[model samples]
Structure formats: C-alpha cells, structure tokens
Target: MSSDLGRAMPIERPDPLALLEQQEAQRLPWLLPLRHSRMAENPFAFFRGAAVVMASDLARQPHSGLMVQLCGDAHLLNFGFYGSPERQLLFDINDFDETHPGPFEWDLQRLAASMVLAARSLGLSEKQQSRVARRTVCAYGKAMAEFAAMSLMLMWSAQLPMKDLIDQRPSANLRSYLAKVTAAAQSHDSRQAVRKLCEPDASGTLRFRHQPPLIWRLDQLDEIWLGGLDWHTWMQESYQTYLADMSPNMQHLLSEFVCTDTAIKVVGVGSVGTHCPILLFRGKHPDDMLVLQGKGAELSVLAQYVDLPVPEHQGQRVVQGQRLLQRASDIFLGWYTNPKGQHLYVRQFHDWKASVDVGKIDADGLRDYGILCGWTLAHAHARSGDRRAIAAHIDEPEVFARGVLEQALELAELAEQDHALLLRGIASGRISST
Candidate 1:
C-alpha cells in the first residue's frame, strides 16, 4: 500500500446538487423527476445513483497504480446472481455500465463504501457497519492472495454457484434465506417475464402491457419521445447490427426468433431516464418467447479521470469489459448503435437475475453477503488484471482492510452529507423530485 493508502484526498469538493443537475441534463427530460425521487428515497439509494460524485472524489486520491478492468460503480447491489449461458446460477458482479480499465483499488473502495452505507440503511449499529466494511475489504485481499497462488487456468475457471455458496454457509437461517433467493431467481425466465409484463392484444398477438412512465408501447408514446425515428426501421436495422456483432452460433440460434414488439422500459436508479428498450420475440411456436433488453451506454464515469483509451462505441466497451470480468457471460450479449446515434448494448432480460435486498437483511447476513461480494470482486479483478501484483501490494489483509475501511467510512459520511444536500435541494425546489 502507498504511504497515503487510506489518507483523505486533498481536493476541493463540488456542490453535489450542481453535479447531479449537470448529469441529469443529458438524460431524458420527463424522467428526471423519477430519477431524483428514486435517489432521494435514502442515502443508500442516493449513493447508488451518485457514482459520478464518487468518481470525482476518487480522482484526487493516491492509488496503488495497478490497473484492472474496474466495475466503475461496484456497489453491493451490483453484485448478484444471474444465469450463465450454461444455465448455471452463478454469483458475480452483474452490472458493467460504468466498467473501464482503472486502478484495482477504485473498485474495492466503492464496494467497501457501499457496504457501510448499506449497513447503515438497514439500521445496523456503527460497530456492525465497521465490521461489515472491514470484512469486505479483508475478504477481497484474502481472495486475491488465494487467486495469486492458483494456476492461471484454475483462477480463470473459478466460479461461485448459488448452490455451492448456500452449502458453505454455517448458519441455517442464512442458508435458508439464500435457498429462497436461489429458487426465486431460477423462476425469473422469459416465461415469467411474459406472464408479468406481456399480454395478448386485440389481434391475439403477444405485446408488452402498457405501464405508463415505466413501460410504454411504441404507439402509446408521443412523437417527441420517439425523436422522429421510425420504430419499425430502427428495430430492423438495430437488430441486424446486433446480430452481426454476436457469435455465429448465437446468431444462428437467434435467427429462429423474430422480433414481435418493443417498448420503452425505464429501469435502475442510475440508468433511469436513459433510452432503454425491451424487445419481445417469438420462435417457431407461439409459446416459444424471448425477451431482450437494450440499455443505452455512455462513456464510463471513470473515463474522464483515468488515463485510459476511450472506446469509440460505449456499448462495445460494456460488452467487452463484461466478457473479460465475468466467469460466464450471457451468450446474447452484443452492441449496436441506435437510430439516434447513441450506443446501446443488448442482452437477455430477467433471465434468473436476482439480488439480495441489503436493506432487509440483518447485520450477520450483511457481513456474510459482503464477504461473498468481496471474494467475487477479487475473482473479477484477478481475471482482468495482475492477481500476483495486487496480492503482493495487499500483503497484509488486516492492514489493507483498516486502510480501506478508513476511506470507506469517510466516504459513507460524505455520501450522507450529499444525501442531505439532495433533500434540501428538493425542499427548496432547486432539484425536482416526485
């Protein structure tokens, strides 16, 4: 670790509300209220949406100088269980919207800070929050050491299955909770999405159900929202481009399915107000359905701060970063430039995607969850960066833990201050919130 590993960054902090407003300007105008409201829900929620704020703060700090493909917004909620292409329920960092090559410590710091904020949101004691935060960092260091000792092949092939993770838990209650989460996740396939989000239209063709402000059919939206783009032509050209970017085998499999419908589907705290669309496809049989989501991607938040090559297409950056970091990626993952010239990544939607609600878990469960996330993050970093160098720098897990926890605690406090500022902005009508 550097002499100033956990030392606070010496830089002037920007006004949180101003930074937020500037960022919001680039997003959809009407959905700004929803984004503000979601972020104002709590400090944890605020922290989740304020990745840009943290990126600014971290930019001024001294780092280990060891670069890795970072999950730029590595909050706890971003680490979850999702179905692999092989149909296994694997636990890993699931979001890569902000992923880019940067110092390995940036990801660790973000995760550590999230653990503290998440624990605080759950009403856990300060002692408990400290323990959870430290445990997360310590587990990350320990995992990196273990990865360092493993052969490259073994380390690259490692994966954490939900079943295996559940079996390893010592507490029956925790195991039971994990088991329930696993079962629920397994049920979140295309069939489940169709039941919940789709319905038969007057023509007896399956189409997405209209849920205004969240999900809206193409015809239901105004011309301004569509920005004069021809929905049919856009979908046709976009799907062709997406298919061209996919593997030949996956493209062959997709050739069997024809896109039937598409709807604007707003999702996620940070991602709200972005141009995200959900597509419904039908195969040879009416019952055979597939749902895919296209999320607009921009340059990573870390790109401005780090001296790395900027990707020409933001969506390609996300797909490539995800492929390098995840143990097993979704086969349908691909990128395309939208009609508006915005880059968007496409992937299977809600295919056994599951996340633990940190706000609902007890202190013990939070600690366990943090450890799992920590180890998973280490595995991701090990795959994309130098495990041996990171392990050597981490040398002593306890020391590294203390340093990261110190920085995380400070960051958690900074987030609280920012959250309070957001509340004040809403109260004064300076920031809009629904």
Candidate 2:
C-alpha cells in the first residue's frame, strides 16, 4: 500500500556532487566558497547545508505518500526557541526556506539522519547513537498518536513551553544545560541585536557597523556591484513594497519607525549566498529601534521532486508555509518582490531567537534533545497533515519506530559516503576548498 508503514527503502544512488553543483549554480558565485568551507566542517555540518541533495535522494525512496507541509530542512539545528506573539517562549521548527507540501516521511527521514550524523560528531558510541536515533523516531510515533485524539482548537493552541521541556530533562546536567540555553535565548532580544550590530556614527546617528566579507553597507561596495543605482532610493522602494504587504495593524506599528540604515548581511550555512539585507529603523524615542531582514526566497527544492504546484511568489510560499508549521509566527512576517523580480520575505531580524548548542550536549542530553525535536516535528506535521492517517500508518508504534530507525541508519551511511565524496571533490579541484 502507498501508505504502508513498513515499506522497503529505495536503493537508488544519485550523484551527490552533481546535485550539490546544480544547487551551487544558482547561488551567488562569491558566496559558494564560503558555503563550501562551512559544509567541509563535518558530516553533520554537511548534512545541514546539503538539503537539496537529500531532497533529490528522498525523491527516489519509498514513502507513505501522505502529504504534509514539510519543514524541508528539519535537521536538529533548525529547531529552536523563539518568542511567540504573546511573548511566550515556544520550541518549534524555525527555518522554512525549503518548505513545501510533500511526503511526510521526507521530513522525518531528514531529521533522523541528522540525529545520526550529529551523534557521530559528538563522538557517541555506535550503540548510543542508535539509541538516540531510535528514541527520536519512537517519540514521533508517540506524539502523533497523542495528537490524533486532540480537538482542533486544543491542537492549534498547544505549545511546548520551555519550563516543561526543562522539567523533562533526563539528568541534572542536562537540565542545567537547558537552563543556560533558555537564559541565553531570553536575553537575545532586539536590544542585544542592536548592541551587537549597531553603533553611533560620527554624526551621532545609530547605524550598522561595517563587517567585511560577512556584512557591509551598500555604499561601501563599488558601483559595478550596485549597478550605478542609488542605494538609498533602492532600499526605500523595497521597504515601501514590503510595508504595503503588511496588515493595517502591522503597518501602523511600523509607521512609528523610520528607516535609519540598511546593509548586506550574510546569514546561515545554506542561506549564505542569498540576498539578505538588514534594515534598521528608529522610532519616536532615541532608543526605540527595530531590525528587519529582507531575505531572498527561492522555490523549494522539494518542488522538483513532488508534483506540487509551483508557487507564484516564492516569498509568499515561505510565509504561508511558516504560518502553517509554526505554532506562532513573527508578527512582522510579510513578502514583497522588488522591481528586479527578486522575491523576498521580511521579518524581525531577531526577537528572542535562540538555538541549542549541539556540541555542549552530552549523550544523555542528546537523547533528550532528539526526543524534543521529534515531538516538535510531530506537532508541526499533525497541525498541517492528516494526523489520523499518520497515526494509523504508525499503528504498531514499535514496529514503525524500528522501520524508521533502520532507514535513518541506512541514509546516514549514505550521507557519510556523500561527505567523503565532497572531500574528494575538493581535493581533486572539482569543488572549491575555500
């Protein structure tokens, strides 16, 4: 059956280098070296940056054929804590750049494989790594079963609070670690972002500080890069289009602020080459400031594999997918296309956003974190997909869990080989080492 729980995994082997090269062809040429350098760090790092490769591979694999809005890159690193509209700290999937409606298993598989690679990076024993991987899969099955019986409103309003997560810690050390992460997340508000990225210029105006290669003001770049256009005018036009997309309340909230400065900021391993502009705005009061990011959005890699409809506007696709998967989304979330036809989604640069430091977690902590991530993924899927069908498919929980774990292990092995291939490509000069 297409929705069978224990379908055999596919054995087709695609060329990882080919897929990666294809993806690189679309990214900024200057940033490809940085992307390559970052992915070269380790298997886990490679896994995080190689979503397109996995998407290509998963397309050939057997699936339940149950479709859901996927967090296309659901690796552990992408799940994080952020402040909800109500100022509550909620743990959920944070990145939706590759999001699209596709096979439910694609998300689980990516997440499971990530667990395996992450455990390996942490120097966990094979047995311990297998345990962590299995725990993540089992947790998903258990959580989906619970969600299957939930009322619509109950499911909609449900959130995993930070305190509840901390209380579930397997040991005192893990609990202490979570406490520190939560504290850090709580402190990562707009003020901290401003302090880290902004300073008063000689004219006494708060402006973004210049950081070359990673961040810089548009004025600092040559005319050739700017295409002889006025930076301020171009930025203002983009800002107005973004403002027009916002709701009246959001617009009114933003109306109190005026654009102070804008800069080209490089962000994330996968998103490094994209057009990410940080816009700083100041409100009526001297200290009142807001930072917004205009991030370029491209079509999801899943679109090539699935028979999904091509999104008319890539930015809107990201915004819609984010709203579907996240329990609460950024209030300032919106989309606009510039005159150059570049699709971009706008949101607060940082509003109490934080992520777990995977390296700091011990074996016990990894297992607990894996379970939390599984639960979070299940919740997101349950909200957007048919939970009953998923629950029924995972009817025999242990059996389904075992199946997922086995497949994850298989895929992780493949990913390791792919990582090796990348290293060889770099050594052979087929790929850049920079």
Query: Residue 389 in candidate 2 has what lDDT?
Result: 97
In candidate 2, list every pair of residues with a backbone clash: none
Give per-residue CA lDDT, model 1, range 299-394, as digits (tens). 787877776775789999999999999999888899998766889999889879999977556788889888899999999999999999999999
Each candidate's lDDT (Cα)? 0.88, 0.85
Task: State, as a TM-score between 0 and 1, how close model 2 is to the true structure.
Answer: 0.95
- In candidate 1, position 332 carries an lDDT of 85
Cα-lDDT of candidate 1: 0.88
Model 2, span 1-434: residue lDDT tens: 14332233357766888888886675667777788888888888888888988887787777887888999999999998888888888889999999998878899988988898889988999998888888898899899999999997898777776787998777676788888888888777667788999899999988889987688787776655544667787787788888898899998999899998989898988887887889998888867888988888988878767766646899999999999999899999999886666899988898789888888888898899989999999999999999989999989767887888888888788878888888888899988867
lDDT of candidate 2 at residue 168, scale 0 to 100: 71
